[model samples]
Target: MTDDGFMGPPWQMDWTPKAQAVRDTLPEHVRKTVDAVRAELVTAKDPYFRGVDTDADLPDGMKVRPIQSSVPKGPRIFFFGHGHGWLRHTFVRRVEDPQIVVEEVFWQ
Candidate 1:
């Protein structure tokens, strides 16, 4: 949440419950990948390797159909892990430079 401006829609970190019951509800791969993504996201700034798409731009009308994720008009990305039933989901698309306008789009 730096002066980097609105990096996209407001998002919250993992809200998974600490309860054992909820822990065992999702598929094994989902849980494992979630942890994997979590571990990477915890250190997204490292260049050696990276997790999650923090700096990537989201194109208009784009949808993550190949994976178990959703990208509403709010323009953000979501975890491909277990679907959070009713938990609030957020979309974020990075917008670079407030200046330099042009006629075409640049998918940086």
Candidate 2:
């Protein structure tokens, strides 16, 4: 936990260009939804592993093979821990120092 006493993920997370690009295209309402999800991650005690659904498909041409987990939320805007309604696919990883790096975002 930081000085704010919030219990977030074992690592901090941030948006990659991919995620940001998707966010930039969303409507204000949808963006708010994605924003809320991100805020939750910031305060979540296990953001990396929380709310992860392995059945979700990545943006790659591959189908949903139950081999990956994504953080899809709020009508599917598609973020790392974001995605509201207009975004598509995203990847995230935890760094050695306990930080989650949002790798990329993709569309179908």
TM-scores for all predictions: 0.30, 0.45
Candidate 1 regions off by >4 Å? 1-23, 46-76, 81-108
Predictions: Cα RMSD each: 13.6, 9.3
lDDT tens per residue, model 1, 1-108 = 446654322222333243234435657755554444434333344211223653353222221221233422322233243333211222223454211111111111
How many pairs of residues collide in each model? Answer: 2, 6
Candidate 2 lDDT over residue span 51-82, tens digit each: 44532433322222112335332112224322
TM-score of 2: 0.45
Lowest lDDT sum, 10 consecutive residues, model 1, at 99-108
Question: Best lDDT goes to which candidate?
Answer: 2
Error of 2 at 69 (Å): 6.9
lDDT of 2 at 80: 35
